[model samples]
Target: MSVSPSSPVRNPWIVLACAATIVTIAMGIRQSSGLFLRPIELELGVGREAFGLAIAVQNLILGLAQPFIGALADRHGAGRVAAAGAAVYALGLILASQSATALGLNLTLGFLVGLAMTGVTFVVVIGAAARAVPPEKRGLAAGIVTAGGSFGQFLLVPLAQGLIGSFGWRETFLIFAALAAAIAVLAIGIAGRPRQQAGISTQSFGEALREASGHSGFWLLNGGFFVCGFHVAFIGTHLPAFLADRGLDPAVGARALALIGLFNIIGSYLFGLSADRFRKKYVLSGIYFGRAAIMALFLSVPFSPLSATLFAAAMGFLWLGTVPLTSGLVGQIFGVRYLSTLFGIVFLFHQLGAFFGAWAAGLAYEATGSYDLAWTASIALALMAGLLNWPIRDAPVARLSMEGAR
Candidate 1:
């Protein structure tokens, strides 16, 4: 297979670096959103479910917008889309800080931020990075970009915590808004549309969707990622509160979330390497099973700050390892022509899982004053996801195989 070099304008290293930076700033601030739950509930006189609902709505909007936005990225390019998204993301954060009611937050944070994220987050950025590299390099390239998000989580979560400590959650958000705006400048570095190298104009987005829909493996991939979304959203949003419910310092949860970010850098990179060397499907299956095992251990073990920290480290290593592998698999099997659009559909399923995960956790805590039921659901889903990924027919689609032959 003779893969062509990227366009002269799209420097692989530069695009990957920009993609990483974008993911860092975007995901870092977004993931820390969970940290504001307690303070927001107190100041706004809203319940946990209210705040959770807002975040839940954000995830839903993100999922709903991905395919259309992804198709646009596929056709046009990510530069303008990402820049506009950065602008909106910054504006949303600024407005969210000024919000006086939960409904106001729902509009600013939930709706606006959710829409902006589709532009700056993995789907758009990963598509750009994938286009900048050859097929063999896609897995590790995706990993490198995903690791950037972990780095942000490591650094920014703690930074947000400190800022909230000294100033307030609203002030912290204003600061993050400034950080969000920076992505627009970086978007220039990643500019370039992906041309179809495999076969020119052989497939349309509708045909791509139709082909994938007929493939059992694609649906299985979606089912597995659904569990991944559930685990990530549930744990990331609720872990700090769960730890606090057991009589620990609020800072402990913050540190734990940071630790997850720190270790995930190594994990995502390693898993990226693993995907290039091993079967992505088996590796994905292992990751899901490992998550289930670790969460089960967390539940059975006695509660302590040390235990929470360890759990964070363990889960963090597994945190986003799925992103590179999942996206990589999509490219490996389907080809990268409409990689962003196809993966966007997969990500929609992921966000659906996230929506349910975030909302259900709040409902569980409100009704039972504990997250035990949510945790159980996460564990069961993880196990189920493990099985779902195991049987995927990990091979290139017929068209890709024919293209490779050419």
Candidate 2:
């Protein structure tokens, strides 16, 4: 379905803050998986491909579950859905820590955690934020929540690296489990039920879904976002290993990741404000072009600590900048009536790209003995994504246009 109307939350800012916090906790733990990769491999003797495959599975499952879970949030309330997911998230982390086999990793890290993330991630939390605030503020609100995820990555990735160094991977995971469990308490603070604006023509979920599916712009949005997912998942999951291949220190990779997260905070915020002020499709186009340029620059130079740090900072600022603009376009064109569901479907395409990004990079590296081919593909994909977003018409659907006509 498409974006929906409004909600009855007392203070919209409170809802925005709580939703952002939930995103921070949930996404932070998820981003740290890469930090666990080398340690888990060294300890368990799991090969990189096997681990990468499991991580790919996690992304696929997360994408697959979003539309369904988002629907549940829209119907039942984001708070309840988030609370339940947090329980599952903590359970998944705990079990993942205990796992010794690849199959166990698939079940715990790939499947369960992936499933739980759908409940707490952008589709649910940002959707809640969208409905809670006035329409004019939705882009900034979505950006704020999206930034929370980046902040978490910035804050937690380094913390996780330190914990992994000091406490060991298993114990570090247990500590993360405790952090994930806190999402439930925070979920209680988000908006519970979506409320219809009085006298406004309300759209059913199916109607919104149909409207979105029929729109050409929606599919273009999905296409562009798929590229975003591929870029983000590939770099986030594999950059550490890529740096290590250049004979750099492991801590360097962690710092690079944290830098990406840190810079992304600025990126998400600036992109959010830009979406509000400019043509969202144009903003999205620029982001994709920026990503292509950054990657190209990273490859042209020697792989050194300074270069890697600079690359991460450049890449991070472009990271997830697409979230607010893409989701904003959905609400802008379709109306915020069923935003969670429509955006969830769009997110599925993103996850498909993520699955391939994570898995394909590993396969390429394993077969070619370097990530050169993957790097080549990433650059090409970014250029193509920029093209995809350039022509997206942001006109509202007939339903929304007609409603406004009244």
Candidate 3:
């Protein structure tokens, strides 16, 4: 439970602060990109499907690169990896500002931004933050860090909307590019050697992979997380457009997104505390089930600004609430040594679902001119995810268990 004298971070709070700041910048900018969809499409005279595909590509690349990026963080240090990612992220935004074609957008926004995100986002930040704290406090620590992203969402979405309304999307991109550069400086605070657990065996990276691969719970966790990606990506990417399609003001969508982010701060922190007290799988199941119910209600009711805000608030409370619990479960079962790599593998599945969610929603809207199919699909997937988590055995792995017994 004690940090070694040689550890770079003598205080866990410093690590949390640095990781939270990095996420605040990286995720804030990334999540707000959806607000640019209509502006970019209108300016370039491109179709929604094309722009959506670009975002979809971004999500796919982000997911695909996570495992490798996470492994790099595991092998090297999170601070350096995250700092490098910040540079890539900033460069990507700058390049994206000048993109005039779908291919250019795809490369800069999708591939480059996504690659940068792999280092700065949850897999690296949360994993590193979790390692800095004691085992008992990992869930709450992860929750506090995950809430940083929600705080970004709350703060940035509205700001991005206003900036786009005034300065144009390209100018806004330039502004965000500058902010991305700041994340590199914050990464230095979290940079350090991995903390060593007292009793856990020193498993090789390959050995850790083999252990996770053989565990049924690991796959179940991945399955449940897939739904998380779908819900968040679809809503984040399309909600503004969806509101506009319903004849609502565009500001309504931005406000709704901000509300979701605001409430998610509370949800993430509370759920993280809950995970420390209850079974993590049960907490995850409850979150997925809540998402299904909330989505269904949002659809069945008449469309109004009030309804949208209410839905946003309700959904926000459930949003990102799963993150700390899911990551905590991984640490509980697998120990924290290779957490970045293992969680990255699980996150890849989440991103795969994200790819489908963002891309398919666009495709469906373009074809049918409605998001009915995507909404219904999300509801069904939420239920499925809830079921998937219910049966997971929330226990320490054999190595950790044996070590504890000794």
Candidate 4:
């Protein structure tokens, strides 16, 4: 890979840094919403399933919109899409504040916010970062950007918890909306004009999808990511409640989420760097297996604040660590020509898992009066994800190379 040494040394790094900042701020507040679930349900007089369903809707809508918005960004520019998304997201929060029913809240908070997330979150931001860096450094660049979201998790979860304790959940959301609006400026900086031609013009988006659809490796990657969504969404939406049920303080849940975010900073970077140096599929396999072992350990031990925090920290290291490696593999196998779209397709699988994870946890807990089955299912799925990754051939598929040659 040839390094493109531009006359200016600082420009590339600055662009990457800006992208990271945007991802961090947006993801931090968004991920922290899990901590708000219990408080909101209590104050608003709603059931756990209702709030859970809203968040599930949010995740599903976001997943559905991601590929389309990512494709738009790939075709057009990230800046305008991000700007529009931020505005919609802020408005969703405002509308959520006035909601009198689950249906109203779900439409505003879940659908609108979820759709907005497509532009502000990883697929768009990381795709931009991937294009900004030199070819050889794309994996590291992707890691740096994704790690920003983890950093946001570390900082935002605790902050949101404190805000909720001091003010109220509704007020907390309003404040978060303000913060989201402020972060939109970073999106503007990153939303450079789209590159019209990146040397893969002959291959249309459909062709790219068709190529990936034919490859068994793509399906394996997608399937494994489904497990990833299940793990993260289940924990994010329910972990706070789980802790409260276990007789731990709500703040402990907040801190646990924070710790997961903090440690993932290290995990994402290390895994991303390793992806460049080692086989990405193997690194992905290890991450999924680690999640399985960690979840089992979390459930096996007596529930305590310390055990919960430890579990979160361990899981955090594995959390979103999948992003850099998976995105890197897509880039390696196909090139960055239609990265946002391909990766968005991959994310749809993740969000589908999220929908089930969020909804099932609530339904199961309500019925069985326990989260044990959900935890056990997560463990089993994690192990399956590990197995799925083990067999993926990360090298470029023949069809892609053949098209490139032509």
Estimated TM-score for each candidate: 0.97, 0.98, 0.97, 0.95
Residue 68 in model 1: lDDT: 87
Which digits, one per residue and each the tens of the lDDT, describe model 4 over residues 264-344? 999989987887898999999999999999988888899998899899889999999999999998888877768889999
Q: What is the C-alpha RMSD of each candidate to the true structure, in Å?
A: 1.6, 2.2, 1.5, 2.4
Model 1 C-alpha lDDT per residue in residues 60-99, reported as the tens digit of each score: 8998899889999898898888998999999999999999
TM-score of 3: 0.97
Per-candidate Cα lDDT values, in order, are 0.90, 0.89, 0.90, 0.84
**TM-score for candidate 1, residues paired by index:** 0.97
Q: What digit string (tens of lDDT, one per residue) describes model 3 on residues 1-406? A: 4543224477788889999888888888888977999899899987878888888888899989999999998888899999999999999999999999999999999999999999999999988888777777888888898899999999999999999999999999999999999999999888976755555556788889999999999999999998999988899999989999999999999999899899999998898898789998988999999999999999999999999999999999999998999999999999888889999999999899888889899999999989999999999999999999999987897788787786
Alpha-carbon shift of residue 172 in model 4 (angstroms): 0.9
